[model samples]
Target: MRTLGLTRTSPVTFEEAERVVDEDGHGDAEENPDGLARVYVSPEVDGWTLVIGPWCDPCDGERAPEILRLCTELSVRYGRAQAYYYGWQGDGSAWLVVERGAVLRRYCETGEAEDEFFALGDPLPLERDRREQLRLSLAAEGSGDAEFEDEWKWAAFDLAPEIAEALGVNPLALTAETRVRGTGVLAVTPHRT
Candidate 1:
């Protein structure tokens, strides 16, 4: 619900992935099942390691710079990394996509508008499609105004889960039907202490 992250990997053992979580640890790592504040690294679920926590939150304006840098580092280490912050409202949602250490896309919504810094790369295909669909819908009502202008921003709130599904996995949609291997465990970020 807070944040979700994914990295394309091939049979990476939990120990191997745990190293990244403990990379900057000034304190020993602690495993917690709750995964509330700590990073919860889920075993390969449909081929992704779910990095869940505030550490991966992508829409925090104050933390955008740090989050970007961290994702770059993670992608470099893991080959690919993606994260999302799904706000409870139809605003403040964000998602990031990285491949082979380069950021392919990064976007975040700030209420009615978007944070320019967090807006990187062209809009993803689905984003463009979302706006277009809304355009036609608005046209049907013979209307286009504030909603049309901010469609891209608020649309992400609806599409975050879809985007996650398209690119990899949606942490929120995990079910018994989902393919899962091993177990998810909490890893304390070194910066947490």
Candidate 2:
């Protein structure tokens, strides 16, 4: 057992976890502050165990990308661990398994690895302008009372279509309310065509 790729020597602490890896491309860990986390990879499976501060959130602006990087590195070094990634929701953070630029699966405190949710690939080149516009507009809405409602409306109407195209799935059709649900958008499997 060569210890797959990366492994944790001890219980990874928050300070050690946020010490920063490849900072130039991933940005500063301090930027994420309380959200810092560490993933220890074992050489056997390149198995990774995530350690985090009690307040980390995977969806937070700063930490999400770092978590993404950890997944990317794991996939690259280990081929693909069935464990994918693990996050502790008690800490408001999560881990996922990404391969070849796509989030293949995710693992939470729950026992199983989930596949229903995944990233929709990179944004379409043409949608760059539109996405920026939406981002700016949504930023203006900020955390106002109406922000949630307004943002959902904008995403459904303005952003979903482009994102759908980028992901090669029809957003309108993926929801259960849509007739095409379960027909078009498919879980990409190793063997499925």
Candidate 3:
């Protein structure tokens, strides 16, 4: 089964998203040359997963809104949350960070050293300063300064409100913890020490 888009007329959940995709036969098994099979929907600890085949012409524009809506619902229910989108080409993947029903940030790594960050809300200028400090720290740790050169890479600005209100801490005080994940990409875990 294949769904062109998620219906916004009603609430959506991870299970519901999975059911829609499965019922539509979108999850049919197919051989993957790169050894990574396409995943339509799967359960995750933080939220649900959606994998779009690289050849799916409408996946990015049409299906992404539905996924984001489902993710937003999950975030509202689960406090801090995540909704992941993985494209089975060129190391395409995106992590949607949500907290208290708000989308705080989007962290994406499409290839080696091809990292992107996007902030969604207004925070104080101090947050930007703190983020710059964190970027410098990441650069010093060998993640490369180029990753921080992009404005979107400064995700801390978007996360500052949540950090200050929900987490109850200063963004500057949090220690930067970078790690290599299963995808063979380096990312800074969005948690404080």
Candidate 4:
């Protein structure tokens, strides 16, 4: 496969994986128990697992909120935690990395934590488009209370539900009640098919 214009044909060694992980601004490896698939999230970010999806299902959407609710609870008692995810495209599987929570950095060779890494590409414009669409949608919904603070808080809540809830409003209603003027949640709800 192609990686930064280079073609590779083997799996990445633990060393290679660690390099990529570090270059992407992930914290040091000693902090990671698993090495490759493991990421160094801050205690706050560590508190949640942003659920990707079960496309076309609002229940999947509901699940994200549920996770936030749980994380909120966990954060209160357990402090915070971290989690990881990988991509599964069509049928072929391979190595990749979740960069800055948006772009994917696909590896040229097979590797462990195959589903967790995403190949690199433009993530910001897409996120911008999504925020615009969401803004318009929320406006159409007659919720003019749109604001970035809420979106940022929502993102933290989305990532760590237990922390969000522990601090009120069940997740479902909170998200539904919330609207966005600007967004801080980088990961979008995966496309529903």
Using all chains and alpha carbons, the TM-scores for the candidates as numbered come to 0.69, 0.28, 0.34, 0.19
Which candidate number maximizes lDDT? 1
Worst 10 residues of 2 by lDDT: 181-190
Q: Give, for candidate 1, the lowest lDDT window spanning 10 residues.
A: 1-10
Best by TM-score: 1
| TM-score, prediction 2 | 0.28
Global CA lDDT of candidate 2, please?
Answer: 0.33
Q: Residue 54 lDDT in model 4? A: 23
lDDT of 3 at 150: 45
Tens-digit lDDT string for candidate 4 (1-193): 0110112123333345335444432333343322222222111122232221121111122333333333344444545422222222222222122223322322111222222232233323323354465563323221434464245223322222232233221222234334323211211122211
Question: By TM-score, highest first, what's the ranking?
Answer: 1, 3, 2, 4
Q: What's the residue-level lDDT of 169 in candidate 2?
A: 36
Query: Could you tell me the lDDT of residue 2 within candidate 1?
Result: 24
Residue pairs clashing in model 2 are: 3-43, 3-44, 4-42, 4-43, 4-44, 5-43, 6-41, 7-41
lDDT tens digits, residue span 125-151, model 1: 777677777663424221335555465
- Give per-residue CA lDDT, model 2, range 1-193, as digits (tens): 1232222235332333334322311434454333223232211111222222322223333445555665466557655422212221222112344565456533232221231133234323434455465563433322344654344333433333333334343222333342321111101111111
